[model samples]
Target: MARLRDLAKLIRTKNAGPFLLTLDIMFPDRRTYDRVVASGVIKKESMARFFSVDESKVRLFNYEPANAIKVTVPRLVTSGDPADTDLFGGQQFGPLVNVEVPDLPAA
Candidate 1:
């Protein structure tokens, strides 16, 4: 097995807006992208669990051309709210980095 952090070229999170956070899973090549997408480990339900949001509130966009998957969820705390620890939502991607994925064949 391989961790998502190993398979993906870049995994990051940021504020889509004051009320939403976006996670970007970018793969280095088409082979890696295809493997990750087919793995089915990265989906709305999984993302919802990772961010602790309702499944219906997670929006996933697979941008094939860019070899990237984008997931957006409602922020647990509004940006700049007193309870918000990550003002830019940058620190919210921890859960996704360790997500397990089937190993890729050697290049």
Candidate 2:
């Protein structure tokens, strides 16, 4: 398996709004990005499940030029809410760091 942690040079998250967060998965190069995309492991539905967010609230965007995927989802709790743990969602990308994506089997 080629885990996302291996293919991605960086995976990070930040506050998109008081109620939303943005995640960026950056690949080292276009080859790696293509491989990850072909692997079919990082779909929007999967991310919705992984992040415990409703699929309707998740948006996945691929930036081919940047070789990155940008995802936006509602924050687990509104940013700066009384119960919110992270104001900036700075640590939210941690869950994606170790996610595994199986590589295509050699023919």
Candidate 3:
């Protein structure tokens, strides 16, 4: 099974704001990006489950020009909150790294 880490050129997470964290998955090209999108492995519901956030709070954006998929979810605690270990949310993308992405359907 090809994992997300293997398919994406870059997978990163960062603080969107004090209350939100954003995950960016960028592919090397549109073909790769489309494969990931079509595979349906990176949707809002799955992301909500991965981050333990409410489904309504998860937002996904597909930018074909950039060959990227962006997902934003509410943080459990404020950015600087004592309970928040990831001040910059840079380490929050671990859950998605190994997500198994099935091969694209044969045309």
Candidate 4:
């Protein structure tokens, strides 16, 4: 968790702009995931959509990815929550979360 915080701090200082961290989890484990969530390094809601998984089952904050990257801000397009599909009577998966790192901001 400290490492993640350090990484965020480093990126913030070096880039001086909004960044995106993509956490790709090949194998999902509970304990490791919980630790990340408790640390509050990344936003849970953002992560859930990033992985394209159920937010309820998978807590974004708790998730630890085998690989991650600090990139530039992305154009987020939120469709809706997965749980709302039943009510909407249509398959409405959450919006696609894409990250596009722009030029580093001036310090």
Q: How many clashes does each candidate structure show, in the order listed?
A: 0, 0, 0, 4
The regions of model 1 sitting more than 4 angstroms off are 104-107
Per-residue lDDT of model 3, residues 1-107, tens digit only: 69999999999999998999999999999999999999889999899999999999999999999999999999999999989899999999987899999988789
What overall lDDT, based on C-alpha atoms, would model 1 receive against the true structure? 0.92
lDDT of 1 at 43: 95
lDDT of 4 by residue, 47-67 (tens): 456444545534232224642
Off by over 4 Å in 2: 105-107
lDDT of 3: 0.93
How far does residue 29 in candidate 2 sit from its true spot (Å)? 1.0
lDDT of candidate 1 at residue 104, scale 0 to 100: 55
- Model 1: how far residue 92 lies from native, Å: 0.5
Output the worst ten-in-a-row residue range by lDDT, candidate 2: 98-107
Superposing all C-alpha atoms, what RMSD in Å does each candidate have to the true structure?
A: 2.0, 1.3, 0.8, 14.8
Q: What is the TM-score ranking, best to worst?
A: 3, 1, 2, 4
Distance from true position, residue 24, model 3, in Å?
0.3
Better of 1 and 3 by lDDT: 3
Deviation in Å, model 4, residue 67 alpha carbon: 13
Tell me the whole-model lDDT of each prediction, alpha carbons only.
0.92, 0.87, 0.93, 0.32
Give the per-residue lDDT of model 1 (tens digit) for 1-107. 88999999899999999999999999999988989998899999988888899999999999999999999999999999999999999999887788889865667
